[model samples]
Target: VVYQRIGNIPGVRSASIVSGRNFFSGSGSSYGLGFVLLDSFEERDADSLSSEAITQKMFMRTAGIADAKIIFFTPPSVPGFGASDGFEVRLLDRTARDIRDLDQVATEFSGVLSQRPEISYANNSFSTTFPQLMMEVNIPKAKEAGVPVSDILSAMQGYIGGFYAADFSRFGKQFRVFVQSKPEDREEADDLNSIFVRNTQGEMAPISEFVSLERTYGPQTIGRFNLFNNVTLNGGAAPGYSSGDAIRAIQEEAEKLPADYDIAFSGITREEIASAGQAGIIFALSILFVYFFLAAQYESYVLPLAVLLSLPIGVAGAYASISLMGLENNIYFQIALIMLLGLLAKNAILIVEFARQRRQHGLSITEAAVEGARVRLRPILMTSFAFILGLLPLALANGVGAVGNRSIGTGAVGGLLVGTVIGVFVIPVLFIVFQYLQEKVSSKPAVIHSNETKPNV
Candidate 1:
């Protein structure tokens, strides 16, 4: 019905809605709905609303739903980890209370979950209204009728749940027979009473005569997480919110949760928390290797220091750019920083290497520095400008994981701009300083031809 209404909206070529179970067939995905667009969202005029505004408006316009929230499932994972895409909180079932009380607690926590302005689509994994018929077998009555409890259960299964009868082959293929009652006969809750079992006297006896029946509605499915009954609450960060912010919101809610209730994150959020510093570790290791290689190449510690020290300029740029752009210091930005470590280091190395060569050729320290800076300025500008321009598209991209992409691109640009332009000025000065120290230590006051010495040796 909602889809039908949405389809009527102008510029909406088609609207599709898919539930998690319908799509995943109970595989790995959770319970939710996926709304898709068949045509690009079009704004009819300047006053026309944005897609998000229109979606929220239409959702509110559709009258009937008691509670409605517009939530965008976090965009699909690149590697396709097969599960519903949403922020999830696996609230492991509480042993401290029964399912009913546990449900009440979950409801309260759900309210807490939705309270965060940064969160949306807070919902539970459990679906109800599964009408269940509970039967209490009268053992004595069944025995007096010569029907065993097992026989009674089998009879009920055959009628209500379908039982395997036998297999028959036709056209060279065998098919299993499923025995069930006529549709009309078992159409209602009272129909189960009419089911019959064979007694010792070989007479058909209605199951109702020896069974007590109770009717109730319950969950359609029971889920266990890590060997404990659990209900997962699914949600995601609001637009323009990062997962880090979402995690904080989740943590705040968790901290206030009852001691008996435990919460664990799964999917993307789990990976984020678990691999928190792994990216930094990778970045640090990259720099370590870079330094090791540079040291081997220079065969002098002081020259390598000059090159590595110049990286601070680029690092400063990355930090400043992301902060100014309101981007997170996330994995993408960190990865870009590692790349910058190499990039800026190379810029520094170029100047340092040239200046050292000049010094080796007997040029004065300041002269060597000024000459190297003069020579490398043009090449530095060309390559860094090219790299910065190349990143423009990435920094401006908008869509799934666009946040990370923009962070990476923006950080790279900022770092490159600083490292190349300013580095042309700074690296040579660093080389001159470190090189002067090197020459001072190396040129050691001529062992005065040992004129005053070594006669004792």
Candidate 2:
């Protein structure tokens, strides 16, 4: 209703409303109850399917239509403690057609409101109505026996909730001194009555005389996180809309709500943080290793500098891919770009290393440069294809954590594909330039003659 009202205002494009079970704080039972009140079933359809069709499909899939309604709750909120006087639970055998039916039943008592239309009425009270036995012991009766209320309460607490006696210190560690009755003994009401509490006069009194017990159903405390009864509102944006844009719009709408309400960005946001952190660390290490490998492979630091120059081409391709794909340049993609640097440089290293070897063998720099790329082309292409194919499934994955996986996979593939293509050509050019400088400054080429050959003075 809030969304609908807001959407009807000027400049508003569209609005959707949704509600669901309060799973976070409800009874911890697996089959606890809850419901969702949507403005319209059609408007709130998750897959754009009609409510009746969705219901029918769910019933058919479960093979028990009658059992399906058993889990449904009608009025979302039931009476909790100190609020049960005017309320009564009504079981509905027939489905409610409109909001009036819900309101009529809900307002039968004062201060009662219909449950949000979105929740299942039948399932709403399972957690809230768990059977509990409440007892109030007569303190006056215990006083006649010279027993104090504190002693009785202490005895009960010790037996039911356990008491910490002292801490045992051993070696540099401290362990708790826990005391409690056995579980089986604690479960019996008779066991509770048998607990003895000492009074101010040092007289022992059994708990039974001081307290009365009653069994009834009631709700436990309702907890709130940042107040407005937090709940997960699950839905997707319309077709042709980006998830990020849709989420941003929803967040903006939520922010306009009263300050008492709080909404967290969970699910994808949580996964992105973890995956991005891991990917970043891995990428950083990979780059460091690659740098070391290159430095060790080439004895001349100047040659490694020429090879490292090809890294920027790969970064450009990675950033372009994320931008074109409409993906945020997030941690996963950043890490993937880092990984791409190594893979990108591998091709450059092959061509550059081979050219350097040829140059040292007394071949002219241009001839070595041309021959190195031609010789390494097949290996570079083969390796690039292998990496791309290997990442294809990851790039397309939609399962849990797939968003981060796809980000990394796509970024790496894009960078590697572009880098490999560029490196094959550009590294050779760089090698020629560096070799030209080496030739200009050197008086003699470092010839790799046979080990047995002697040099003339």
Candidate 3:
């Protein structure tokens, strides 16, 4: 039924259903799986035919399914990390309590996440309603019957669940054998009465007197994580939010869970959380590297601030543009930010380097600042506009890899546009302030040449 329904979805090119497990064999308890192949980009040109849109349609179409909990998810963009995109959170039972209790707590945790605005969906496959059998051994009854408790259990294991009897060597090969009762004799619980076990007296007795059977319910399989029983919740971030935001949201909500329960991230979410602060660190390091290079070039420690301080303006511009464009702060956007930093610093360097040269040649601080801006303005605009125009195709990209291209292009373009337009004015003022400070703190004035004319402002 689900296969046919998903096949009928507008953008689905093909749909297949498989029983027992998915292709990756990741879900041991999953009974059935469905694969949907979407139409090619050229065939599905409408915005409604996008992957998210088709997934939403699938959810709406399958909402009437009461016998099964249907979940739809996109495959992970990067392979070997997980089976699907989004966060994989393991809800751990540290004390190894009853499976039913774990199921109850996990369900409640998923429900709480579902209500969070940052989460699109939160659910787990762990279930405890499957029919199972409960076997009880009467230890006292076995002792009274002159039979050992281990003997009865060994008999049951051998007859119902099968046991490794022995290994024999034949024709230079080893053969292992298992023992189990005949299918007809093990058809029902009452059949156990016919299986006999020998007591210490060498007399045979039926095992029914020493064992009891009752129908119960439990999960078909249980999984452990970090050596504790765990239930995994698979979910994605809501629209307009990044995976980082979803992770933080889950962490905040997890604090409200019982002390015995803990949450651990796996796959992409784990990688994201593990490297959460790396971007800021990388940015700081990149700036420090540039600052040191500038210090060496100018042979002064205080002069690099004029170039480094102008970077925040470009960073602010990049962030403001993405927010206005309804884009998230993802890896591609951050990459653009690093590139933006280099470009903006290059523009600042042109003005500051020129202003320092004029100061050494006998120009006043204010005159040198004005002269530097006027001399470097044309080349800065020319280069900045050329770079921005070159990225226009990427900013308006379509088809494959469009999202990443757009992120990089849009961020770079926005940052450089704002930085170049405003930076020409700000760089000179920064140079004047930092230059005055550097001159005041120095022990001697720069070697001024009286033969050179003063810089014209």
Candidate 4:
């Protein structure tokens, strides 16, 4: 309604509601399995390994393996897969009993993406892609070397990963006590072996003696949506062009690659959610402000209703303006409609308040209305024209924020132009009707006075 009102302004060229684009599979929740091309493995070597062999090795070395393949397939339209850029391998595992356990593995897997430069953004289903490995030794493993599990666990925990104990006050500041091995030692297998685990007999034993330490890839730390692994590559678009256009271009480029891989864009939902939330907030605030203003001005609840009746006339003008001006129904125009309510009601208040005062003076309904309109007409016109003239400059301004400002200014000016003219004429007619009803209700005789006659003396 607001857009229509402002659109009719003479200088408004075009107005529209613009929003960000959502790609086919850009959302983090989308599912799919993607294969990462390992530089260490040659194409011929990867192809030579049977799918079963690959699956078994991955399962034994890592955790569960879903599907394994050599060269991934893409849609028919995409070009060469065999010689295309190396791909990142991803698998979906949503049915695990503990989702967080699986998420831990997925988080660790994301680390692999940062290790490679050729790969782009690796999307995942798991909410937390970082994984932390925690190890608890079996009593049997500790006892075999005559060591207490607690002693070994404490020493390893402190030396390997840093154990935080308590804070120490130093130089008027508190510093935490964190004990851990240096970075280089933590990364070496030989250094890890040097860790000493005390035996129950009070003898120090090498960590490698009884407990087997295997550094295997953590569980599927990241999650996949719909049981599919998805990836997205962020690239630049032409200046002044929309993201949608860039996505379509990228999609076309993707088609030129081999059809062995499945790729898509999926960021639309986020954009929609943001736009809806913003619009909803503005709409809610606008309504609340209008109600508050009306309630405060007229002490009687019924008088506010009469003022609100003038709103439809303003709304009708707004609609006509938008249609005539060719603007979109957007947030800026909505704000204009809100402003129009106040302007329209201002005019109505002038007429209604005047008529009300005259009625209080014991004037008849028709006499009160005509006299009110005659007295208020000049002031209403003057105020309305003054607002319109002030807004004209804003509507004509140019540059960075000019378009948005003009949209609002133009909408309000158009509505005010129409509303002020109609309000003056319509409010008087409405006041007359309402005043008559009020007077009739208040002037009724009391039942106890029916037969009583009192002389003037």
lDDT of each: 0.72, 0.58, 0.88, 0.55
Which candidate would rank higher by lDDT, 1 or 3? 3
Error in Å for residue 438 of model 2: 5.0
Error of 2 at 413 (Å): 1.7
Error of 1 at 148 (Å): 2.4
Clashes of 4: 54
Window of ten residues with lowest summed lDDT in model 1: 444-453
Which candidate tops lDDT?
Answer: 3
lDDT of 4: 0.55
TM-score of each: 0.79, 0.45, 0.82, 0.43
Candidate 2 wrongly placed segments (more than 4 Å): 1-23, 26-147, 151-284, 327-339, 361-364, 398-401, 436-444, 447-457
- Give the clashing pairs for model 3: none
- For residues 200-244, what per-residue lDDT tens digits would candidate 2 score against the true structure? 787766677687678886544432233323222333322233334
Which is the better candidate, 1 or 4, if ranked by lDDT? Answer: 1
Tens digit of per-residue lDDT, candidate 3, span 96-175: 99889999999999999989999988867778987778889888889988999888888888998798989999999999
As for lDDT, the candidate ahead, 3 or 4, is: 3
lDDT computed for candidate 3: 0.88
